[model samples]
Target: MKRSETFTTVLTEAHAGSRIDLVLSQVFPEISRNQIQNLIKAKKVLMNGKVPKPRDIVEGGEEVSLEIEIDEGVSAPEPQAIALDILYEDDDLLIVNKSAGMVVHPGAGNPNNTLMNALLYHYPPLKDLERAGIVHRLDKETSGALVIAKNEETAEALQKQFAERTVTRVYQALLVGELISGRTVDAFIGRNPYNRKKMMITEYDEELEENPGKEAITHIRVLERFREHTLVECHLETGRTHQIRVHMQHINLPIVGDPDYGSRLKIPRKFTHHAENVLRGFRRQALHAYQVGFIHPKTGEDVLATAPLPKDMTTLIDAIREDHELYVKDHF
Candidate 1:
């Protein structure tokens, strides 16, 4: 279903001297800045009776008009009975522990057997909400806790928390190398011009003509160490595509089994046959969204949920630990 609505607002003194997109975004918090920019681009937004640029400066007392076409309802994908590992649920939202290899939503090649389809089948009412009430996403190969809003009010509230950087997200990852200490990786990440499928630290990559990237911050601390690998925790400050993986690679400790950002495969000599096989056979990035915490939109209370490590990651860790113990017994 498609429905168009027009809104008009007059700028106040406090809103003066701000970018048009910024002004409109604050005026209508429900509409995202990106959506506001698109409205300006499509000639659906007018400032003081003139179609203004998204970057145009706004003065006080100017009339801003915006027309938005809301698309929802029938556009939702069909429900499928795919199973989900739910961690928490309430009237407002639910936390799902998404398994590795399950796509979050219907996209391009993945049209069925997605978390969205599963949510719709499980809840049914989710079909009426946008993107089946999904407020965030994890990579297709990333297994972890994810939030799904049950209504528009909850969706907007949760989105605001994420936009304001209040929602807490922590990941557990196994890296290919041992990190000596915990550090924060603050870098600008953007699409690789050379490889569109991969993300790169654009600000640090001198070859890029210009940086079309956003700042990404990840605080990593070692949880356990092995002869050739490190289990670490990652706290995300900004949600960027491939933020953890790219940042790890930037620090020369790429996550194990990450096909894109991982370094060349090298099995350490200290590993036993089982350990070597485990390290070599792992196929997806050793990253999991271990926990997510946010305020309940409906109950006004803090909510936190944790997901257990998957079987593959736990098994791999066990093998590496055993090998490390033997290496330490002989060499140390």
Candidate 2:
């Protein structure tokens, strides 16, 4: 059987005068506004102890409540026989290497067959915790090492580590442009005005409907450089939505194959035929979270996990390397 979990919050001056949907989105950044609206439609959300429409305006100090239905066993997201690439595991936590194209949670369009489903199957006990004991997430197109806490106490401890910005997250990204050196980008990231589905680096404007952007900082280091592409390693100091993609695009070095932030495909004249084919075939961002580290909640020892590059990315890099060598040899 399932149980209902209730979450309640009060709007502050910072969120004053915002639409209810927008206010709820800011309060629960993990869930999308569309999902919040869906909850409202299901009569699972209340404002000031009354059901409110999504467009209702909110003033500071108003109480809002959201209810979510979850099970003590495999519930709405029925457990499936999906295999997880286990990286490290203990009684307190489990680290898995999540493949690209795998959704971490169920949402509007994706209601099942997600990592959450697989986790429930792997360890049914996770069904009792929020988000199946998952404390963090990776985008569907971003492959990476992810950590999952196993119990309520451990979940709280893990969440505190992430909130304090103590968790170490490292990624490898293939960019569309070349870089002579590494750089650190400190910018504000907010929803794109023209495209609500995308994020961008922008300044806050009082007149615009957009909420004030959050600070995002990424430290980039060039690892290898091709004629038209650069492979770089990024360390995140603050984890904002699409932080790397937005920061890279802001620097005019959008990631290769990033559908939203990438530029139009421009094959270099000197690129070999194979390189062009690989670049054209890629449909997802060339981004991978290679490593993650945190202090274990129970053991009180540091834990680090690393994921190897996926085959597609490895193949892409190989094609680029061959093209670079051929170009250099032909010119010199």
Candidate 3:
């Protein structure tokens, strides 16, 4: 069974003028700040008997209340057996190689057969944790390695590491254009005003107290170049939703097979017939989470894991490489 926990507190002088989310996080250190923000967004946090924005400043002696539902047992999805590619597992956590097209968790229009449901099926104990202990997520079209916590303490520790920007995640992507040098994209990202489902780079002044966008940073280095595309490695600095996809598109070098951000299928005239065919056949974003490194929550030691590129991506890359070789032999 699940239960709701309530907390009521009065802002002290030391907490006055602080952001509501930050103050609540300090007062309740057990809850992650991200969870606090979610609570604020869900209208579960009230200040002075009214729902307050996450960034609202609190004056001393103002009453604040929070209501959080805690799950004590597995509830939804009716766990059914599903295959998982396990990378590593321990008493505290587990790492999995998530396949492309698999939703990490269930949401609107995605009711079941998700990674969360599969995890619950495999590890019934995870039913007691939120989202089956998933601390972070990869987009449905992106395949990669992801970590899951086994207990509440490990989940909080992993969330803290992510919040502090201490976790390292490296991804491999095939972009539509050649990149001459490594570079970093530092931009704010938010929902597209015109299309609510999509994200776009936002222009915001850092000095503003309430910025609509979240800060995102991605560092990319070219690994290989073809006549019409480049294979690159991306290191994430902040894990905003669609961070790599949006950042790459912001620079006009969208990932290959990215239907939303990429340009219409227009193979370059210089591309070989085989290369064009391979590129056209790739239906999902050519992105893979290749490596991840973080500190172990229980052992206090560093843990790193890597997943090889999936078969589809590897086949596409091989075709592209063959084309590149042919171009080089003819020109140089």
Candidate 4:
């Protein structure tokens, strides 16, 4: 389904000298700045019946009108009766604990048995939403809480929160090396120029170059440290592809079991057999989206969700702790 909407607003003196796109985004908080810019580029927005540039300054008393055609119904994927670890659900949205190895949506080589498929099976109405109401996504090997909107309005609202950087996301990971203290990684992330499959942390100004990358930031706090590994909590300031993994690797702390960014398979000579086995056998990135918090799109209330560590990670941490204790006793 598709529909058209028209909105008109009169600017005040306070808005004078601001860019048209910026002013419109402030006027319509639910819509994103990118969307507003796209509308301007497409000539769907008019100031006194004339298409205005995005950078055009807005003056007081100007009549701004915006007309846009939105696709109300999105093409949904096939519904599959896959199980979902649902944490919270309401009329507006749902919070799900996405398990590792589960792809959030269908892509090349994976067309079924995804979270989107399962969502459609449980809520048929989601078929009308974009990406089956998935406002954000978790990588296939990352496990944790994720938000799914129930309708277009809610989806747009939640998406705006993400764009505005108002949503909070915290992840837990076991990096390969011991980190003494907390640190922040502020860099630009872009697909590797040599290998498109991997992400690289480039200079912050890389965004001004070809194949521009987006700004990415991750704050890491050491939770526990072992002789050979560190368990840390990561707070994402900007969400980008392979953000945590790439940022950790940038600091030479690539996550354990991360096939793409992990260090070569080598165990410390002094490590216990069990600890070595746990690290060697791990098959996926030791990263989880443990917590997510955002404002409710409909109720305007703060909503937070947390997911417990999966069994594999918990087991690995236990082994690391035991090995560290034994090593300390022997050395002392």
Candidate 5:
């Protein structure tokens, strides 16, 4: 899947003063400036029969040949004897519905007892696959469908599709309040200067905006509304750090039980709308990656997987319903 595409631009005086990276950015915005520099370093980017340096100035009407390298991206972790849910498994790939509260992979302080640990224990052969066995990730709190790579080749393909935003992931959340009937929180998001741990809606400033992140789009629609809660469905256009949670908070409606970005609503820990809101005793972010769809890495065939709400989420929903119903009957 390593394919190369070319672009030839007639650099005008408009492009003369700009650096090669900036100049190409205007011509080829789909590719990043760093990627362009990578081609130059690899001697794949030539200007007038020579490898033009990064800072080199391009004159008007110069032909720039770019031999871009395209590879599907995949990531893996240190292999260990991790026991996986193993909803589906084969030689090429597998799909598993992660439970709530399980960290997807190993990280600071959580080196063991993670999804990676279970995965490692399940697929000892994945030692060679590395993160290739881990194609997509679910946040430690968010539970739902994830695709795992069995080998390096499958990992690469899944990574590429995820990077290009071709994969479809659907997350359901219970917000603190009733949201607009149908809404899309279309706003630019930046890191919180005040808190390194959070992303927030940032003001527009040249200095802060220069190297800002790309467009993050979210489509949200209210599914159900209780007295003080709103169940909503979210579709993500770009997968940035905490995209759904940040966008929801940016609009002043954070997910129920989300520690960092959620608006604090005074409710019992029993929250969330998963399991179609039928159970009780649920806590956590109240967000679930319920469904995922994509093309199979090797077969290129459409694939879709759905995960039901975990017991914790379902239990909480049912408890809330019974509690509220009883309260209303007694009060009336």
Candidate 6:
């Protein structure tokens, strides 16, 4: 009913003693356990070399490989000629310069015109690989570097690194007002009860995704300060949905063009694309993924990637710096 490559998996000894069913459930969360049991009955699920029963307990020191073939047949996504700024690529990985206004993946309200669709066009065969090699994503309005895996093995390895907090992600943002040289924000971030679509810092009980609530830690440094605005560099020890934007807002120095997290005088003319007078000249959220560092999934060597600031933010910063400085002197 389905087809896929002979995907090789290596389950370490620590994972031993867990039921095979649990492994299947973890690997494929979208599919129910009942579905997995059915697949196993059909001899679709294989262990290292043989098919294993659902109740079979995993041995800690054993290696388990699975070949998952899903019938969600791939419909050749119609290719759209979307321009991509690829910064670096190797056989196993790619570092791309995602421009502002490009959605990272296919989602409601945006199915065809997405980075995933364009990537499918460029790397059609990769679609059949383990997980489409899309290890991470940048917000549509946030431009900058993003790493992509080219194969299943690499994707798995990189994903593990991300889970272990071994990968490093850095972001840059131009925020309203002055900031200190360096600081850290430690807070519990969860969905806002009043606005489910937005995430905010919470002190008490917080809403979490079905999985769990994550602790987000952010390190920030003031790169440059203008009279009223500050260019800041942020490093994430832990990444969560909208970690930087909300944390910055918690500090009362929200990113200049972010509408969702800012208040009153700082909402911006446009965001700056969606409105002009609201956040004004700054078009999109003044955020960029400027640096990413990780260990090479296959080679186990250190790898670092960087993307430069886009023109819109740079141009906006020039004006913000001058205006911010004047504001600081006059106001402060």
Candidate 5: global Cα-lDDT?
A: 0.70
**Which one wins by TM-score: 1 or 4?**
1
Error of 1 at 322 (Å): 0.7
Q: How many backbone clashes does candidate 2 have?
A: 0
Tens digit per residue, CA lDDT, model 1, 205-236:
35634344656899998999998899999999
Model 4 lDDT-worst window of ten:
204-213
Best by TM-score: 3
Error of 2 at 229 (Å): 0.3
Model 3 lDDT tens row, 1-332: 78998777666665667688866765664465567899999999999999999878877778889998967563466576879999989998999999999998776678688998889888999988866789888989999899999998898788768766789999999998889999999998766778766778878557755545666899999999888889999999988778999999999999999978887776876889998888888999999999999999888898999999999999999999998899889989
| lDDT (10s digit) by residue, model 6, range 1-332 | 57664444565543456577655554453345556678778787788668888878877444555556745454544556777788878889888899899888765577688887777777776677544577876788999988888887788888667756788899999887779678999986766667766777866434522222336799998888765568899999877778999999999888877878865455432132333332466656789999999999777788998899988887777655555455557658
Between candidates 4 and 6, the one scoring higher on TM-score is 4
TM-score of candidate 6 versus the correct structure, residues matched by position: 0.72
Question: How do the candidates rank by lDDT, highest first?
Answer: 2, 1, 3, 4, 6, 5
The TM-score that candidate 4 achieves is 0.78
3 or 4, greater by TM-score:
3
What is the alpha-carbon lDDT of model 4 when measured against the actual structure?
0.85
**Which runs of model 3 end up more than 4 angstroms from their true locations?**
1-43, 47-54, 57-75, 205-210
Residue 230, candidate 1: how far off, in angstroms? 0.8
Please rank every candidate by TM-score, starting with the best: 3, 1, 2, 4, 6, 5
Residue 260, model 4: lDDT of 92
Clashing pairs in 3: none
Question: lDDT tens digits, residues 196-314, model 2?
Answer: 88988877678855545666899999999999999999999978889999999999999999988889998999679999999999889999999999998888999999999999999
Write the residue-wise lDDT of candidate 4 on 231-273 in tens digits. 9999998788799999998899999888998888768769899
Worst window of 10 by summed lDDT in candidate 1: 203-212
Report the number of the highest-lDDT candidate: 2
Q: How many clashes does the backbone of model 1 have? A: 0
